[model samples]
Target chain A: AQSVTQPDIHITVSEGASLELRCNYSYGATPYLFWYVQSPGQGLQLLLKYFSGDTLVQGIKGFEAEFKRSQSSFNLRKPSVHWSDAAEYFCAVVASGTASKLTFGTGTRLQVTL
Target chain B: DTAVSQTPKYLVTQMGNDKSIKCEQNLGHDTMYWYKQDSKKFLKIMFSYNNKELIINETVPNRFSPKSPDKAHLNLHINSLELGDSAVYFCASSPFDRNTEAFFGQGTRLTVV
Candidate 1:
């Protein structure tokens, strides 16, 4: 079965601290990876995606993620956390040629503390 | 302007009542989808339509039906609503084929009484 996992249900980081959110996925074929952010009472917004080429991808709001094929991980990272960065982050995947049916992880809620 | 929009941002209905949620995307994308976000905040795909044709249907109840009048619109209708059916329904759209990122609507919160 294909699935995505976000090990941490919630994470807290003080403002200006480095942050990392872990994600792992199980898929049969080459995977199309994505990260989305959702704020309170708001819709999901695409942060970044990994399809091919470079393993490291940069996203909006100074966020970036690296795709590690060996470990089946695509962890999100940021050099410094901001209070506004506190939101629910989701990792999603779709099998190649699957017609955009995304398999989403359980999501990680980031709580930034000042 | 919203790239994707879903009508009835909040809906509260009685059990066994039928209701529908409409979705529209103006990004000129070829694919649309409906996702359910449960109380636990787990998001799951319910249906996918590409070019107004049903492409993917997950293990959803038969009471839930999705309709696509065009490539830019997808609508979901539920019959005989139940308590477990109360959830946040999100509509999203993406471009056709590989390496596409989906745009999501504000989501509709459904409550069953």
Candidate 2:
């Protein structure tokens, strides 16, 4: 079945440290990958999405993700982590069709330390 | 603002009860969706409606019903809710198809005790 996997369940990074959250997906066609950030007591916000064109896509809040077709991976990265950036990150993929229903990963929680 | 919005940000109810969550989007979107965020904060699409028609329905229980009166409105009605139903229900909207970035609402935290 089609699915999205975020191998890292939980990650911790210092306020100024670089951060990376990895994601892999299983799909048959050209997948439409997306990264979403969920702050505490809030809804999921779109960080970035990859539909076509360049493999590296830039997103809001100084975040970016690269979609690698060979690896079937779309990893989210940040140059410097902030205390406020500590939140749950999810990677999702839309099925190939008009439905385009999104399949989300279990999620990866990032903890920012001092 | 041209954004998706949901009402009753917080709901606290008991099991075996019935409740409804309402959603609205003024983004001139043609599709509206209902998603559930579990306790562990995993978001999944529950249902989708396009042009007031049900397009995609996941393997959700029949107790949970979604009604789209119009293109801009879709409401979820849950009957005889169970303890496992306790989670955050989110409402989102997209302009046309699956490739579009969906706009989300603040979410309705439904608590079943």
Q: Per-prediction TM-score, please? A: 0.97, 0.97
> Which parts of model 2 are misplaced by more than 4 Å?
none
Candidate 2: fnat, from 0 to 1? 0.65
Report lDDT (Cα) of residue A112, candidate 1. Answer: 94
Best by DockQ: 1
Docking class of 1: high
Note the B-chain TM-score for every model. 0.98, 0.96
Cα error, candidate 2, residue B40 (Å): 1.9
Interface RMSD of each: 1.0, 1.3
lDDT by residue for model 1 (A1-114), tens: 689999999999999999999999999888889999999888999999999999999999999999999999999999999999999999999865658888899999999999
Task: Give stretches of model 1 more than 4 Å off.
Answer: none
Native contacts retained per candidate? 0.86, 0.65
Task: Please give the distance, in angstroms, between residue A24's alpha carbon in candidate 2 and its true position after superposition.
Answer: 0.3
Output the TM-score of candidate 2.
0.97
The prediction achieving the highest TM-score against the true structure is 1
Write one digit per residue (lDDT tens) for candidate 1, span B1-113. 98999999999999999999999999999999999999999999899999999988888999999999999899999999999999999999988877788889999999999
